[model samples]
Target: MSTDVVQIETRESRLEHLPISFFASVMGLSGLALAWQKGVHVLYIASEWVSLVIAAAAALVFLTLLGLYGAKVALHPSHVVGEYRHPVKLHFFPAVSISLLLLSILALNMWPAMAMPLFAVGASLHLVLMLLVLNSWFNHDHFQTVHLNPAWFIPAVGNVLVPLSGLALGYVELSWFFFAIGIMFWIVLFTIIINRVLFHNPLPERLAPTLFILIAPPAVGFLSYVRLAGNVDAAAHILYYFALFMTLFLITQVPRLMRAAFFLSWWAYSFPLAAVTIASLTMYEKISGTAFFVISAVLLGIVTTVVTALVVRTLVAIGRGRSACPNRPARDPGRLETQ
Candidate 1:
């Protein structure tokens, strides 16, 4: 190819790859961490501090990579996926990944000193992204049976909640402002989605179930905040658990949307990972007995194993254009990097 043609091709390729590359990388980090966290339980039974340390170290590295990517995205907005078009949603992976890395570092260093800021960053950015999503949908036509791209929402919410989970550790500050903003976001997002289903444009059967899938992560975040903030009152617990269960019920339909197992979206397929995480919370709250934590932990382990393997496989397949029932072939990998 001529050099000019090659340059044009490269630029086009960069635009195409921007969206999925960030998502795949972010999901890869979450999947691997869940796997390691679950695996460590077995090894730690033997008091394997060394193994635990190594596992934690690996997690730190993963978080660092995720954070670096986020920083790159923030510095070079052109690299933001789908930035060329509406600029509706500012993908939260970059911001959330940085928050996760910082939180992890604070935890490892025993730095109560740094925990509050990390926590605030996580909590605030999460609210910001949620608001953006809400505002976008509120103004746009979200119905019309639009073909949902699982890649977009999956990593978006997952990455945000990963750090938001730190709120559970009790090392962070709570702002009523943040929570209020979050509620507004929730209001807008749900309104638009409901409007689509009920009034405006109805999603087709094929695309309909994906709506349920999109609800998973944010639902998880709601549950995670309640769980992590620790000390839920009777009313609070009841509300949170009710929402949690409903979310899980929604997640059950994901496989149906994907149809053939071979045709599952990298995003839709990974819903199980988020589902597993949600399941853990459910078990944590539902069973109040001594065996409660253990049983839930086991479920989390199984879910983690299955989800992580699936994510890794998808990454490989997408990287090589070998996905079993590929919907969209991913762009060239090199175009993911921005100068």
Candidate 2:
């Protein structure tokens, strides 16, 4: 009876502490699926089956997360509401919708029947989540520049992602609507984040990985705009080249980033690398450049390695019970600002 009691408590604890950021794993896995799907079409080296398997895995993870998070809401309404109001965690609620969006893209090719519904639900939910997060920022008396990080870009990235499948599904006006939101906010957040990073105290180890997220908006925007406008014109050039430069710039910081203690935030590395990989493949397809092909192949290899490591580490953390260790502090330190 005591053993049963202990197990029940442990399970409840796990549910209570389950981070909204876990949806990022779905984002990473889904991005990997899409990148591989694009790779097979562009590189012609891998079987599409590889991507299909990844997409299935992503779908399973998303469903599992959805179920678990639903359970959390039911069993631990206080914790769920707490996360909803959290300064940093508030930005993550959209991750649920973003996961749905990414899965929609993945399913578009594999299970056409599932695509539109997922897109519709995901797109609608993300808009609501984004507005809520923005409202919190606008009205809050507590938010500070210290709370700013690349993860703040999460909502904006989801907006840009809308156009990829949205355009192909013939939502031209809707796609542009999303693309504009993504672009406008990307520029705004980029400026704010740059200022925060340049003169401020360095982001603590946990959030350092989110710096990789800076690569995603432009990389995804490039792909979306190219598809929407039907050409790799000057605007596409600006987006793609900016993404490529950010990729190059962050690669130089890999050594420092690698030294950070493992956190769920490390999954941040996966999706951005995957975004750049798909963007590179798209560039090669459009421009017929061997250099772009080489970049895509290299990035494909790197993202695959990074995501595989993250999965293993995460599983290992769960097995060791550190994934939600009660003593662990997932929250960032308070009051950090410019030097």
Candidate 3:
């Protein structure tokens, strides 16, 4: 009691707070899911309102933070928006922009008077602009060729896919105008993506894997449209082909990127989930028998398990002071370790 005591303080991690990008990506995902769940009243189960409200809240929160980050990134004298450290040009801008608009439409579920028109306009414009930005590299003659930071492309594609369920939802309601416009935009965007992957990027070796993950948006849009149209034959064939391609790509590429463990680990863990989800969504619409349903269910379960594990792992790592730079170790005397 008479002796003096020494105290120790521990700092909390910034990542535990969740980065704006992550929040934005999640909102985009939730919005897409809700949009897909629009019709099937049974699908909503119990907490549909709660889910929509939460998604809307996430959308606004991320939008505010992303805006601030973008402004800060833009104002930097040395760094341009397309550069590596802060690659805002890729899909971040378009994803968040469309996300907010979509959330508004979703929140106005009962009232289509304003939401319907806005959703159509917003999705069409957003899809076109985003495709152009992503595929702009096809214009090799441009003054500067932006070497995309895969970080932007990866999550951004995921973000794009997040809204895809909207097409399905609208289709269920027989909102022909929105459905038609959205599909047209998606078809065009898909063409651009296909072009860029096939002709633009120099990294042919990297192309398939990246495209494998990136192509989910158009795949999703296509599936939704076909399902909406009740063209099961086409949808089933496409799903099978897509699954085959994805499986082949994943098997080949995962080993190639083995040296890039952290990045590859993230990719390996997340991408298969995406591939399966897209594949299952497509197959779910197509096949009638138990075999198809079982396969689809299994794939969906795998996707859910893998993604949830990754998210929890990421969050826990954040909590333990490994947050932003999880790759860094306490023993390492690097800048990341210092952070």
Candidate 4:
């Protein structure tokens, strides 16, 4: 092939390999933004602007990914369909709607006008994605026990996130509907995931970081429940404490997580920690407990550190043209980064 023709194909190919899972970065960043927002109030931090800047960055990243993925859809329909069929990556697709939901929350206090539209669109889109995902799983031909991972928690857990903003948007009944679906799915999937972990082979390194996703459904569920229910009660305690327990459980795996190879999935760590941090801050706000304040402070600091590390590592990976980076190496144009 001519050099110009070869170069053109390589560029197009790079765009095609951009995975839908990159939206997890937006979820992580927006979670950090909300955590910082809560920290300022609960922890008496002076750095509220940190939240603004991170929220803006999250929005920017979301737009960029939207445009890029939109291009991939237009130029690479087959590749998109392949991802839609893939057992694992299929779940990550909902991250787009969830990111929108989170960005809606980030915009809530600062821009209520913007927040409403974002929430409306996010809520509507998430329902569609959730249905599609369920249908796929129910009718799938190729799924098996080994295909199960914590990432499967994304779609269901994402529903529990609605009330965090949906309540404020005056969608009281709708918010409850989403929350119920999310909780039911969470219970079902939580059992299946636990069973898989106990009886099946251990998750490979690439999927290990996804264990962090276990923290999000409960943490986000706690935050959403308090907003919807107007106070922390017995049920709230169950969600919050279970999430906290899961967080601690995962901490013991820190040594192994630290040793695992870098994957796009590492972004998995950011949002759950952020979820728990925001939950802690909320708990402190409601009860005036010094312990909740301390816990929130600790979690906020850890999530900030984790996000910073992820950003630096992502930049380095992109520069070196590694797996899952946007600037994928031309030599491997056909490789899907999400793998």
Candidate 5:
């Protein structure tokens, strides 16, 4: 009995070490809220109340995780630093900033007064975080063949997210600037990722879900471009079509994704799926047709189901004391890394 008790204590202790990357849950939840909000306008079955409820839930989760993570930082500053220096896990920091930006966008129609301040804070923080991550990329020689994965998109794609609400909040010029940064880096990163995949081995199974992140930039870029341009022009069509093509292309990898062992990293799939769903809904709005509507509906359902499953699984893992901090001991800090 004493041995069993000690084992339980050890398991419980692991919970205290939960990594900052858990903020990925906030990103997933906020994405779900935003997707539901878009669904309210595009689908007859969706309602404003449902969207508001989901948004509220997401806000609560975000606050709760933020507080928990803050506590972890206070108690284990070294662990936090370890995560920051980690090749793969370092990319997840932007998920916190992006989740904040997403929450601000979700609040725009629900509470405009609150939305502006939230957007201001989120946008400023996102820019700073993006710059910091970019600086690390340039100055830090952490690049490694093993570190190349889709999570690298988090910092780059986060810039595109700014313009989603920035345009609506009257920061048109700044939004365009951020949009340009996001798009330019996305192309550069895409080339690097593809080249890595062709020349190097595939990403480890645990990180395969992050491959879904490849879909987010084009989809989000399409939505942001349409909002900024204020129309479905030729350029908008190009973005939309590219997003559609990427989504279709990535769908082929679903079997490989599912075959991998489940981990918190799987949450990487959630926001990207939500992004493409929102993009589809945006297209349906602009090009009113049965086909677009059907596509939007299908993608929304898939994203909602996937995110829900991931949330449930994560909660269960936490309850069972199986979901511990993701940071492992640091290797050579100067290796070129991408996650």
Candidate 6:
């Protein structure tokens, strides 16, 4: 073949070994599903169909990426190990586990037969992954305040995500176990992250969107707590208010976020926004008001727009040979610089 064809073939090979960060798309899509499902109840609209479509898309993306990542593990095991060992990339591993949990939640109402087993698998995997990630945090020696960011919340926050579906699946005891783990470490990590931000250099611009992740634990925790506790008690109120406060605080930072250069990390913003949207809808259910409905509707719109934009950008980047792969040099001349 000619040089052009050879290079195109080579690029395709590398793209197949995409970074673990790609799973953020799954998280975003799952969030969309949850947001819309909640919107359906509050708005009295046919939004559940939208949620189902997004959920199906998320599952397809999850399976496709899983297959690709599996291939990479089989062919380039060292690369996978290297990612797990890297401090920044390691935090994203929970994206996979969390995505599975979110998918299980979607399935819970839509596909009950599959939901129970999916929740079991998702919950089991999340717990095991949380332990492994925490162990890595303790063992890894590259300790510095600058290394802390909201991405660190994933593993710990993911534990709380389990009961969003697990409770419906009759895994009440197991859900509580994971929720306790998630909330406890969420507190520990929340303090550490706050200290790191206040004392150290700011996180790099590429990770700016990850700051949104700080909103997710409390938001998701509120939803999970309500599910497990079966009421909107004082504790649930505290979680809800904190999440609302964080959501407002983060909203003020959107200008800064917009100014930052885009990267795959921008996908970090999608799921958290969706989490808060769900939380808002949950609150709407508890306290009926036009204001609550308005808040939920607006947040849902913002999340849907963001995820859709990111998906389009990713497809464009892929077509242009600009989707950066961790394991190989980007082939297109302007690829690395743009995103």
Question: What's the residue-level lDDT of 90 in candidate 4?
Answer: 93
Arranged by lDDT with the best first, the candidates are 4, 2, 6, 5, 1, 3
lDDT of 3: 0.44
Model 5: worst 10 consecutive residues (lDDT sum): 329-338
State every prediction's TM-score relative to the real structure. 0.58, 0.95, 0.55, 0.95, 0.91, 0.93
Q: What is the per-residue lDDT of model 6 for residues 1-339, given as tens digits with 9 covering 90 to 100?
A: 999999977755764556888888899999988888888887777757888899999999999988888887887788788778878788888888888888888888888788877777777787787888889988878856776788889888789988888777777888899999999999998999888888889878777788888889999999999999888899998998898898899889989888765577788878888998998898889887888889888998899999998888777777776656544445543232212
Q: In model 1, which regions exceed 4 Å deviation?
A: 1-16, 24-28, 31-84, 87-175, 198-229, 251-255, 258-265, 268-287, 290-298, 321-339
Most TM-score-accurate candidate: 2
TM-score: model 4 vs. ground truth: 0.95
Instruction: Judge candidate 3 at residue 33 and give its lDDT.
Output: 42
Which pairs clash (backbone N, Cα, C closer than 3 Å) in model 1?
Answer: 70-94, 145-203, 168-228
In order of listing, the candidates' clash counts read 3, 0, 0, 0, 11, 0
Ranking of predictions according to TM-score: 2, 4, 6, 5, 1, 3
Q: How high is the lDDT of residue 162 in model 2?
A: 94
Which of the two candidates, 1 or 3, achieves a greater lDDT against the reference? 1
lDDT of 1 by residue, 1-339 (tens): 899999776545533343423343334344334434433453243333433453354446446545554554665566554442232223334335333433453343344565556555655565555556556645755423333233235334434344343544543434334444444445455555565556645554323434544444444445445554455545445544554565566557656654522322333333334444544445455545655466456645554555556556545654654322112333432111211
Summarize candidate 5's per-residue lDDT along 183-278 as a digit string, tens digits.
999999999999988899988766777888888888888888888888889988887788778788888988877875567778878888888888
Per-residue lDDT of candidate 3, residues 1-339 (tens digit): 222322111222232222223433443344344433331242223456554554555455556656645654545423323322333324434545455454544545633465655556555555565566556545534423233323234333433342334553353443444445544554565565556456665433322234344434444445444545567566446645665565556546656643432211242334434444545545554555665555555544555455555455544554555433323343321112101
What TM-score should be assigned to candidate 6? Answer: 0.93
Question: lDDT at 14 for candidate 3?
Answer: 35
Candidate 5 accuracy as lDDT: 0.80
Candidate 5 stretches with Cα past 4 Å from truth are 1-12, 327-339
Model 1: worst 10 consecutive residues (lDDT sum): 330-339
TM-score of 3: 0.55
Which residue segments of model 6 deviate by more than 4 Å?
Answer: 1-17, 326-339
